[model samples]
Target: MRISVIGTGYLGTTHAACMAELGFEVVGLDSDPKKIEQLASGVLPFHEPGLPELLRKHTASGRLRFTTSYAEVGAWADVHFIAVGTPQKAGDHAADMTYVDGATSALAGHITRDCLIVGKSTVPVGTARRLGNLVRESTSGDVKVDLLWNPEFLREGYAVEDTLRPDRLVAGGDSAAAIDLLKLVYAKALKSGTPFISTDLETAELVKAAANAFLATKISFINAFSEVTEHVGGDIRVLADAIGLDNRIGRRFLNAGVGFGGGCLPKDIRALQARVSELGLDRTMRFLSEVDEINLRRRDRVVHLATEILKDLQGRKIAVLGVAFKPHSDDVRDSPALDVAAQLFNAGADVSVFDPEAMENARKRFPRLNYTKSAAEALENSALTILLTEWDEFKELNPTEVGDIVESKAIIDGRNVLHVQDWLDAGWRFESLGRRSV
Candidate 1:
């Protein structure tokens, strides 16, 4: 099977490479010449664990290729995956469809025969039907394009694994041909017992947004508990473990700390809320708004804790550990750790920040903040330290050794990953969310 994946960003690039690895001839198209050039040279623009190796393997075998022209993509395949970004629009929470519209229109103009155009980007419900009309109109009735929604659910750090063996596959299109083609394309997973669900276009689009909304809600739900836990002097981690033991309540996304801050969760929730309101369901979006507020408040809580610890943040040397929204990924789109660091700096703290992989991206977002090469370097002579993201390096730090680097042995366990008793035993004053430690 020949497939063309448009827009070689994180989703597009990973999708293209994985499809090629699945024994399909894949062509990746991007408007950015630099991105295309880099991919052509077997270089990936972003950091995804095991992606470089996968891209290299497929590109070297000539099963995967990158191109700058949509004409090539249109002519090269019977199936074209529209994986362009639907970023949150400025001044509004709705997703911007400019990239999606442009990619679909361009693909429509170049195709002369029947083709299946699958949307892999997260979009507002009913976008697929609208785009189908636009494609038919642009093609001047010369080509038949079947629009399908196959929203991607791959997380940044686990993109390759998610693509190769997805939890489930949701496809939606009006035509049986389009649905069957997608089924065949993902037959390996279907054969391996991965649920292959087919529905209408609207349901398929809502499935992606709803899935993200649920994950965001789960994180916020725990963070909300963290708030009450702090007041009641309760250990949220232990509480979460106890509650998660229930068969109905799963353990995933229950970590209570700085909260979720990534490219997907933060934006998708707001976008989903905004979309719901636009559809005349304003009351239904209230819970989502609270979820977003809870997530944002966690950042403020971290900053407030730092201020309280130092008595006065003004002229206080504080170290912030971790900037990425999560570990093992360099993306810092809405990172909670970086958000707290920025708030602290604004509140007059002399903050030094460090992260294993997100420093470069964080630097771009917060150029005014001081960035250190190592966590210990960031903690050097610090009055207070905060572990914002639970990276393995941060988790495995020796309490005694870390205590020696700082002038004041005070630390905030933002993610609750640190051993509070161990730090306390090492003569360090440890403060953490959802727990009592003096």
Candidate 2:
């Protein structure tokens, strides 16, 4: 099948490459000329583990390509996947639908033949139905265009794997042909026993938001208890493990760290809240506000812990071990680690930040803080250190080796990936978010 994936951000780029890997001719489309140029040259504009090699290989093999022209994509492909971003609005909690809307309309106008236009973007419920109407209205009567909501459930670092071998597939539309086409598109995964959910457009739209909201709630629920353990002196990690032993509550997202952040959880929760409010069911999703508050407070707790450990922020040199929201990806959107680093820098501390893959993006987002090329450089002569993101390297740091380079012997395990006794035995004062300092 010939495929065109619009909006060559993380989701689109990964989808296009994976589709090409599936033996399909794929073209990734974007309005951004520079991004298109970069992708066409086999140079990904961002960091995603294992994606660069796939992109380079496919671009070299002539199976996958990129272009900024919707006309080129519309006239060329049998399926068009709308993978545009729906970021939270600047001043409000609602999602900004401008990109998705524009892309759909553009695709509608340029399509020369009947094709499936599937949405992979996370959007407010009712978006597909509305966009479907727009497509119907925009397209010529001679050409048939079916809109399907097939929201993507891709994790950042594992987007390629997630796309090729998804946990399940949720496709929403009334058209039998559209559903079959989608089934054909995902035949490889379907054959491997991956569950495929067929539902109405609204349900499919809500799937992404609901999933994100639940995950965010789970993280916040644990972190809220972390706040309690911080005062009453219990181990949050142990508590999480004990509770996680129950099959009902999974251990994932149970880590009580600087809370959930990235491109999805935070914004999706807020967007869900905003969407429900718009539907006049404002109080239904009200608990998400608490979830949001609890997540933000985790970041604050890290800052407070840092202040307590350092005694003062002024003139102190602090090293932030990771700035990406989580390890294995460089997306710093709503990142707790980066925010903590910036907060400390704002308070007159000399902060050095380092991430395995996010230093450049972190610098672009928060430039005032120092960016270091390596973890050792960031830790060099620092009064205190904070392991904010659970990068493998940061999590596996040798306590004695790290202690030797620091000016002081204090550390904050923001992600709780460190051994308290190990740091303490190395003559370092260690603290983590949910544990009492040792």
Candidate 3:
């Protein structure tokens, strides 16, 4: 099946290329001329492992192309996927549906043949049903059009692997024709044993929201335990391991460290709450407020620890490792690491930041802080060092080498990945979020 994907941001760009890899002729559309030009030139605007090679191969082979015109892809492709972003609305917890609505209307106005329009963007439940009506009303009815909500379950660092080989696939629409067409599109994955979930629109939309809320809750649950462990003399990691040992309570996101932050988790949970409240179910998702509170509190704990260690913040050279929310990708939206680094900078500390891939994006967001070329540069001559994001390079650093660089031998393990005894043996004062400092 031929496919056209809207929005060339993280999700769309990856989907477009992966569709081409699955042997479908694909066209990726974006309103931004700069982004289209970059993608068309085989340059990825963001960091995602294994995506660049796919984009280059497909574009070079003419299986994947990019354009800024909806009319072009409208008459050409049999399916159009809406992979646009649904970022949190400013001054509100609800998702801003402006982009999704605009993309749907644009395609509805221009689609020239019978096709399926898939909603890959996360949204409030019932959005698919609502958008189905909007599509029927907005379209000229020159062709038969079907709508489906196929929520993407892509993790940032592992987006490519997730897309090409998903653990499961969910498609929500009432039309059998639309479902069949989607099955054809994902036939390879289906043949490879990827579970396909067929359901109604609301359930499909809720899956994404519910999944994010649960993951956020899991991370906050462990961090909440870390808070207790921080006050009392108990090992938070050990507590997590003991509980996670249960066959039911798997050790996935139970790490006790700086809490979850990224484009997905923080906004998705808040948006889910706001959506339910709009339906007058205010108290239904009330606990998510505490989830958010716990996540934000993790950042506060880091800043407070930094202040306590430095004694005085003014003019203290502080090294911050890993400004991206997690690792392997350059996304910094609602990133816990970046938030902590920014807070430290605002608190009058000279915060030098380093991330393997996120420095460019981090610099764009917080230009006032120092962006270092390497982790070593950030550590040099610093009074204190903080490891926020758990990148492999940051986790593998030698304690003795880091000890020689920093002016004062003090380090904070924000992610709880380091060996506490090793740092202590290096003659450095070490502190972690849920551990007794030494």
Candidate 4:
């Protein structure tokens, strides 16, 4: 099968490479010429653990290629997957549908033969039905051009694994042939016991948003409890573990940390709320606003805790460990760690920031903050240290070794991953969120 994936960002690139890995000829399409050139040259612009290997493997074997022209893929491939971004619009919580809309219309116009045009991007509900109509009006009546919404459920850093061995596959389409053709494209996954969900257009679209909203709610729910535990004397981690022991309540996303961020959770929940409000159901998803606020407050809690740790911020050198939203990925969009670093920097604290992989991207976003080579370099001669993102390096950090490098013996475990006794045994002043005050 010949597969063409549009939008060579994280989602599209991973899908294209994985499809090729499944022994299908795949061509990834991106509107940006530079990105296309980079991918074709086997140089991925972003950081994903396993994707780079797959890209190098597929591109070397000639099973996967990239292009900037939609017409090239339009005329060549048996399947077209739209994986463009639907970022939150500026000055609004709603998702910007420009990329998805343009990609659909352009692909619909250039498609010369009967093939399935699958939408893999996360979008507002009812987008598939609307785009399906647009495709019908735009295409000639001669060929059977099928439009299906197959929203991607990829998690960053594990995108390759998720794409190659997805837990489930959901397709929202009206045409049986279109849905069946999609099954062929994902036949490898289906044969491996991946559940296939066939639903109408709206249900498929809502599934992604609803999943994101629930995840965001879960994170915020624990963070809200973290607020209470921070004020009163209690162990938030123990509280989480106690509740997580229940078979009903899972132990994932329950670690009270510096809140959820990245390209998906923050924007998706807000977009879901905005979309519901647009449909005159303002009260339906209003709690998502609270979820958003709770998540943001976790950032503030870090700032306030840092301030309390270092009373005077001006001219104090503070080390910020991990600026990425999370570890194993370089994405800093709406990152709490970056935001807290910026907040500290703005308050006249000299911030030396470092992350395992996100240093370059963080530097691009916030250039003025001091960027360092390693975690030790970021901590060198700093009055206080803040661990925001829970990267494995930071989590398993040797407190005694880190203790000797800092100007002062102070640390804040924003992600609540540090061993309190270990830091204290190392004779360093240590504090973590949702723990008894130091």
For candidate 2, give the lDDT.
0.93
TM-score versus the correct structure, for each prediction: 0.98, 0.99, 0.99, 0.99
Clashes of 4: 0
Off by over 4 Å in 3: none
Tens digit of lDDT per residue, candidate 2, span 1-438?
899999999999999999999989999999999999999999999999889999999999999999988899888999999999999999999999999999999999999988999999999999999999999999999988998999999999998889999999999998989999999999999999999999999999999999999999999999999999999999999999999999899788899999999999999999999999999998999999999999999999988988888888998999999999998999999999999999999999999998998988899988889888899999999999999999999888999999889999899999888878888989998889888888
Candidate 3 RMSD to the real structure: 0.7
Q: Tens-digit lDDT track for model 3 on 1-438?
A: 789999989999999999999999999999899999999999999999999999999999999999999999989899999999899999999999999999999988888888899999999997999999999997776789999999999999899999999999999999999999999999999999999999999999999999999999999999998888889868889988889999799988999888888888999999999999999998999999999999899999999999899889999999999999989889999999999999999989999999999999999999999999999999999999999999999889999998888899999999999988778888988889877777
| Candidate 3 lDDT (Cα, 0 to 1) | 0.94
Clashes of each: 0, 0, 0, 0
Report the error of model 3 at residue 305, Å. Answer: 0.6
User: Which of the predicted structures, 2 or 4, would earn the higher lDDT when compared with the native?
Assistant: 2
Q: What is the C-alpha local distance difference test score of each model?
A: 0.90, 0.93, 0.94, 0.92
lDDT for each residue of candidate 1 in 1-438, tens digit (9 for 90 to 100): 899999999999999999998999999999999999999889998889999999999999999999988777777798999999888899999989899999999889888767889999999887899998988888757667788999999989999999999999999889998899999899899899999899999999999999999998998999899899889888899989999888799888898988897878878888888888999999997899899999999888888888788889998999999999899898888889899999999989899999988889899989989999899899999999899888999999998998888999999989888877888899988888888767
Better of 3 and 4 by lDDT: 3
Weakest 10 consecutive residues of candidate 1 by summed lDDT = 136-145
